[model samples]
Target: MKSPAPTTNRRNGSFGHRSTPEHLGYSPTSGHNSSKVSRRNPMAATVMSVIGIFTACFTPPDTNNSKSFVDSEEFKSSSVASEASRSGSHKARGSSRGVSITLHNSIQGEPAIVKFTMEEIFQVTRNFSPSFKIGQGGFGAVYKAKLLNGTVVAVKRAKKSVNEKHLGVEFQSEVQTLSRVEHLNLVKFYGYLEQEDERIIVVEYVPNGTLREHLDCNHGSILDLASRLDIAIDVAHAITYLHMYIDRPLIHRDIKSSNILITEKLRAKVTDFGFSRQAPDIDSGMTHVSTQVKGTAGYLDPEYLRTYQLTEKSDVYSFGVLLVELVTGRRPIEPKFELKERITAKWAMQRFIEGEAISVLDPKLDQTAANSLALEKILELALQCLAPQRQNRPNMKRCAEILWTIRKHYRELSASEFRSFSTSSQRSASTKE
Candidate 1:
C-alpha cells in the first residue's frame, strides 16, 4: 500500500472551516473523496461563475521569494553590431562547431542568427549593479538595461548559487522550456547565456511593473470596473493561448498576480515560467509528468499536492485563487483572520451561497452604482475554478470566454444607461422650452 503523504505546516493559518464531505453531500468512500466530486454540481458551477467575475478585479499578493532592490546608477549602452562582429559570424561558428548555437523565434515561427557577447550584456546592465535592478524572484534578479540600439530590456540573472538538487533541476527546466515556447502573453526571451556557474535570460521590459503593484498601490481604486475587466480578459486570453494555441500545452504552476506584468498601456502579460511544465498526452491520463510537489502556498492545487501529480488543471486552480483575490481584494491567506477562517475561497463561497456577496466586494469598488448581478456571476465562476477537483474546473478557454462575455454585457449596459440619460435630458429641455 502507498504511504500517506507527510503534512507540511499549513500556512495562511489553519485550514479554514472544513466543509465535511457529508455537508457538501458526497460520500467519502466514492474513490476520490467528497470535496472532489461535489464541485461538479450545477449549483457549484453557478456559484463559481458569480464569484469569478468579482474576484477577477482584486489584486494578488506578492508571494515571490526573491527580493527586488533598486540601483542608483544608470546602465551604459554598447553597440550590438560591434559585439556581433567580435563574436564572429554564425556561419563561421557553425563550421568550427563547438556547441552549435541556433536562434529561433517561437512566436513568429521563424529563425534568425543571434550573436551577443557577455561583455555587451554587462555594459547594458551596468554589470548587474543594484541601481538598474527592477525586481527579484525565486529564480533570479530582473534588471532594466538599455542596449546600444536604444532598446530597453529586462534581464533575468539566476541566483548566484543553487546547491539544492531540486532548485538546480527547476532552473534548468525553466531555461529549456522558456527558450522554446513563444506567446504574446508570455514574456519574450531575446536570448540566454549559460556560463560555468551563472545563467541569464534577456527579455522585453514591461514598464508598468506587476499587476500586484498597481492593485496594491492604488488600493484597486485607480482600476475602474472596465479597466479591471479588460485586465481579466487579457490574462485569461494569455492563459488560453498557453493551454490551446501552443504546440505543447504549458502549465504555469505559479499563477499569482505578481506573475502578471502590465505593459505601458496597462495590457496584462503573464510572466515567469520558472515553475512551468509541459502537459503530457491525453490518452496517458497525465497532464504533466509526475514530479515533486512544487508551487506557492495559497495557490497550490489541493488535488495535485495530495497526489504529487501535476496537470494543466493545476494552472486553473491557481487562476481560481487569483480570481478570488481580484474580486474580494483579499489575500489568499490572511493572518489577521482566525486560523480556520483565513482561506478566501471557502469563506467567500459560503457567504456567496448565503446571498451576502456585497460583503465580499472590494471596498474600493463602487458596487452600489455598478451591476451587482454581473458581479455575482463572476463570483460564481471563481468558485468553480477553485473547486478541489481538477476535472471540475473550467478549461482556460472557457474561462476566458466567460470573462469576455461579462465584458460585453457591461458595455451593453453602459450604452443603455447613456441612452437613458440622453433621453431624459432631452425631455427636460423640451419642458423648459
Candidate 2:
C-alpha cells in the first residue's frame, strides 16, 4: 500500500504560508513536489539516517581515496540511489507537512542531488578551521576544504550559533532551490547537510576569487578588456538562467562584484543565493515578511528598496551597476564622493550619455586608446539594463547575447587590422627583394 502523504507546514516560526506548486504556477514535473511535502515524516528521517550511514561507509578511506572513489561506478550508483531514496522519503514526509517535494535531475549529473550528512561535512571541512576559512558573508562562513579523494570544495556553513529559528527557514529554502538548479555559468551545489542545529552546503571551489578582489588588488594586468568582457558575459548568462530558465523566476536580491566568483581559467560563476527569492506573481505589489531589508546597499534596487516589491528587474538594475564597475573600475558606493553622487552606475551612465565616455573610463586604462563610440555603445546597453521601469530592461539572456556580440565585433575589427598590417608588410618585403 502507498504510504499516506505527510503533513506540510513551513518550518518552525516560518513567516509565510507554505508555497504550493500551483500557487507558484508551475506544474509538478518530477512526480514529487517539495512544496507538498513535510520535513517531519518518519520515512524521511529514516532515509536521511540511512544515507548518512552510507556516506560514512563509502567516504574515501582518505582524501586521496575519496577522489579516486568519486570516479568509480560504485560511487555513482550509491549517490544516485541515495538521492532517489531521499526524494522519495522527502515526498512521504511532505504528505505530513502539507508541502510538496518535487524531484528533478541536474544536467551536470545526479551527484548534485545526493545529500551529505552533517558528520561527513564537518569531517570534510576539518571542523571549519580558521586556516581553511575563505570568506564570510551575512549568512555564513565559507571554508576551503579538501575531501578524502583530494577534490577541493568550498563549504558554506550557516552560522548555527545565530538563532535557529531564522537559520532553519533559510537553510530549507537554499537546499530546495539550489539542489535542482544546474547551469554552466552558475555555481554548482554538490550537496547539503542539515543537522539539528547546523546546516552546510558544498559547492565547487573557485580558485580565482571574487571580482571585487581583483578590482582591489594590485594586479593591473589581470582584468584586461577581454577578461572584463568575458566575465560580464558569463555573469549575464548566470543571471539569465535564474530569470528565465527556471520554472519559478528567481530574483537574486543581491548582485555585486563580491558575489561573482572566478575560476583558475578566469571563467565567472555567480554565487551566494542566501537572499534570492522566487517572485510570486500573485504578490506582485505586496511586501512579504522577509527577515530584513537585505542586500548590499550599493547594489540594492532603488525601486525595490522603496516599494519593498522584489522582481527580476531588481536583478537587472544590480547587473547594470556591475557593468558600470567593469567599465569604470569604480566601487558601487564611495563615501569619498559627494553625497548626491555616491551611486556609480547612474553617475557614469549620465556622463557617458553626455558624450563624456572618455572621462569616465578608469584611469588605470588611461594608457589604452579610448574608443568613445564603443564605450557609448556599452553605456547605452547599461542604460537600458538600468532603466527605472522594469519593463524597459532587457532580460538576462538578451543582455548576455548583446555583450557577447559586442566582444565578437571588437575581435573581428582587431583581426582585420592585423591582417591588413601583415599584407602590407608582405608587399613591402617583395618590392625590396
Candidate 3:
C-alpha cells in the first residue's frame, strides 16, 4: 500500500463558500451536483469576432521557420530590423560570457529582482552542461542552479534569439504574470534576467519530478488515490487563484500534467506561464478574449479551438481532461490503444455513462468502497468540465469546491469502513478466545 499523503490546509476564505456566487454565471442546479452557466451575451460574441478579424489582419507573420523550439533560431531582421538595430554597440561583442554582477534585496518585504550576469549563470549551470539541464519546454531549457547563499532555483534560459518578435512577447508576458501572482500551489517567481541575446527567468525550485513523470511511474513510486485527490485540489486552487483572486484574472493556457510540478511532500505547484493570458473582464462587458489557440494537443478546449475565443472556461476544460487523466493513469491521447479507446477522456466518460465507472479507474488502485465513491464523484465533475459549450462548464471555484466535498466524503467513508472492520475484528477475537 502507498503511504499516506500530507493533508493540505486551506485558508479561511481561500476555498470560498460551497455555493458559488450567482453573478459569476454559476448557480446550483437540481440534480447530479451540477451548476448552470450563463451564455456569453450576443454583443460579446460580435465584439470577439471583430477582434479576431483585426488580429488576423494586423498581426505580423512569424518568420522564424524552425518548426519546434528545440530547432528554432534567431531569424535575420527585415522590416523588424529597426527594433534590433537601435542598440548598435552591444551587437558585435556577442554574449558577455565572463561578466558577473551582485544583486541585493532592494524591495521592502520582498526579494527584489536583479539581472543575473552571464558569468554567474555559467558558473551555476556549468555553461549549460547536459547534466545540469533539468527540462525543456516551448520557451527554452531549464537548469537547476545553486546560488552562493545556499539558495537553489530553477533557471529557465530562453531559446537563443527569443527577443525578436512573438517569442519575445511571450517571454515578457510570462515574466510579468509570474511577478504579479503569489500562491502556495503556484510556482513563485524569484527574479528575471534579460542581457544581450540571453533571457532567463528564475523561480523557486521544486525538487520532485512533474505529475506526468509520477503518473508514468518514472519516479519509481505509485501515487495513491488520496495523493491524487490532493494534487487535483492543489491545481484547482491554483487555477481558481489565477481566475479570481489575482489583480487581473488570468487564463492558464497550458495546464497539463507536465506543467504541474510535484514537491517532496506530493503537493502540486502549477508552473510555465508562457502561454497564459489575462482573462477578459466580465464586469467590463467583455465576454471572451480573442487569441490564437495555445495549449497541449490533447488538452485543448474544443470551444476555444473552434472560435479563437479564450476564457477561464478554457482552463476549466483542460482541468477536466487532467482529472480524467488522474483517475485513469493514461495520457489524454493513447494512440497505441484500440481505436475506440484511443481518446482516454471520451472512452472513460463512455464507461462512466454506461454504468461502469469503476471499470475506467486505474487498475493499480485498490477497488475499495471509498475509492469507488471518489471515482464516481470525480468523473461526474470531470464531465461537467469537459462539456462542449463553455456555458455548460462550471468555473474553477466550483471545481475546487466539488473536489473538496469529494475529499470530505472519501475520508468519512474510509473512516467508517475502518471502524466497522475494527469492531468486527474485535468480535472475532473475543469469540476465538
Candidate 4:
C-alpha cells in the first residue's frame, strides 16, 4: 500500500498518514555484492544447515546461484566510468546540462552502482521515450535502458509532482539502505541521478519480471512445487540477513509479491526500500520501535497495523503471507472467492489449523507429485509466522532453517521423480521401436 503524505517526522514516533504516492511501487507491498567480504557472517550456521539439508542428496547445481553471478565484469566497466561524468553539448528538456563528477566507490566499503549524469541517462533512454517504459509505481515510472558501457539497468524516476524535499528523502533512503547491505538474494543498486526536478535511481535490470507477474495468470506462468519452495527459502535468507546480519535491524515495511523480482535464473531479489526504517539500536534492549503504519493492506502485520510500533517480527508476519502465496499461488486478497474465503492467509490458516492445508496447493503443481510431509511442515511454518503475537512467531533465522529443511525434502523428491520419469520414457521408446 502507498504511504500517505508526511504528517510527522519518521525519526520520532509521529508519522503522517495522508495518502500520497511514494517512490515505493505498489502491490500488496513489499542486494548482494556486500556478501563476499563477510563470507563468515553470523548467519553461517543457518546457511550451512540449508546447504547440508539439500546437498546431502544428489545436489543440483545452484545455477541460480547469485554468489557466482556478480563479478567485476557484471558491473559498470571501469573504462567507461573512468572518463567521469562530463556534460555534452546536448541537454534534456527539463534539466540543466550534466556536470562531470568522478565516481568513487561507496564509503560503505563496497563497489557502488555507477553514477550517471543527466545527459548520459537521458541519451540512453532517448529522452524518456514512452515506448521504453517498463513499469510505473508509487515512486515513479521505471524505464529499461542500456548505458554507454552496455550495462542494462532500470531507472526509477521520481514523479514530477512530489516536493523536492520528499523526493530527496526517497532518493537518499534507497541509496542509504541498499548501500549498506548486499546479498545474491537482493537487487543490486547500480547508481542514481539527482538533478533539477529529477530524482532517478538506476538498478540492475532484473529481466524475469516480478513474482507477482508470474503468479498472475496474464503472464501464463506456473511454478512447480520445487520452484516455489526454492523461492521461499531464498526470500527467507534475505530477510534473515536484514534482521540479524546488518549493523542495525531494518524493518522492510512492505513484503509482497510485486516487490519481489525474479531473475532469469529464477533467483528472487527483494527491491523497493522507500518505506524501510532502521530498527531500534542494539543497546536499547527495546523489543519494538514505534513508527507510523506503512504497508500494503493484506500483507501488513495485524499487530504492527494496530500499534504504530514496528519490530523485526513484522517482516516475519509479512513473510507468512508470502509463504501462503508460494503454497497456494493465490493473491493475498482473493475477492472473487466466497465471502468467507476472501482473505488468502485467513483461509489458508484455517485450512492448516483444520489439518487440510494441503488442499490449497497450486493446482498447476500436480498435486500427486507434491510431497505431503514437506507441504505440511511448510504450512506449519507459515502458521507460526502468522501468529497474532509477534513474539510467538519464529524469527527470520528460524524460518530460514525450517524452509531449508522443506526445500531439501522437496528437492530430493523432485529429483527422484524426474529420474523415474526418465526411466519410464526410455522403456516406452525401446518398446515402440
Please give the CA lDDT of all the candidate structures: 0.61, 0.58, 0.70, 0.63
lDDT per residue for candidate 2 within 391-426, as digits (tens), equals: 656666667766766677656655766788799999
After TM-score superposition, what is the CA distance of residue 113 in candidate 3 from its true location, in Å? 4.2
lDDT of 4 at 319: 94
Writing each residue's lDDT as its tens digit, candidate 3 over 1-433 gives 1111222222124445654443445342222332212113322242233223321211232336332211121111000001122123322312221234444343432223345677778887789898977777657788887776666778888887624777777777777677667677888665677776788887767678788888888889999999999999999989998888755678988888888888888988888787888888676678999876666767777677666789999999899989999999998878799977877887777666656788999988999988988898898778778777788788888888888888988898989999999999999999999
Which candidate number has the best TM-score? Answer: 3
Q: Better model by lDDT, 1 or 3?
A: 3
Task: Report the Cα lDDT for candidate 4.
Answer: 0.63
Which stretches of candidate 4 lie above 4 Å from their native place? 1-101, 104-114, 162-167, 416-433
Full ranking by lDDT? 3, 4, 1, 2
Please report, as a residue range, the 10-residue window in candidate 4 with the lowest summed lDDT.
70-79
Candidate 3 wrong stretches, greater than 4 Å: 1-113, 161-164, 426-433
lDDT of 4 by residue, 17-131 (tens): 2322223111111110112223234323323332232211112224443211110001110111111122222122012213342364434343343457888778879999999
lDDT of 1 by residue, 32-113 (tens): 1123234446465555554443333222322363321111111111111111221244366334323234543333422232
lDDT of 4 at 95: 28
TM-score of 1: 0.72
Candidate 2, lDDT over the whole model:
0.58
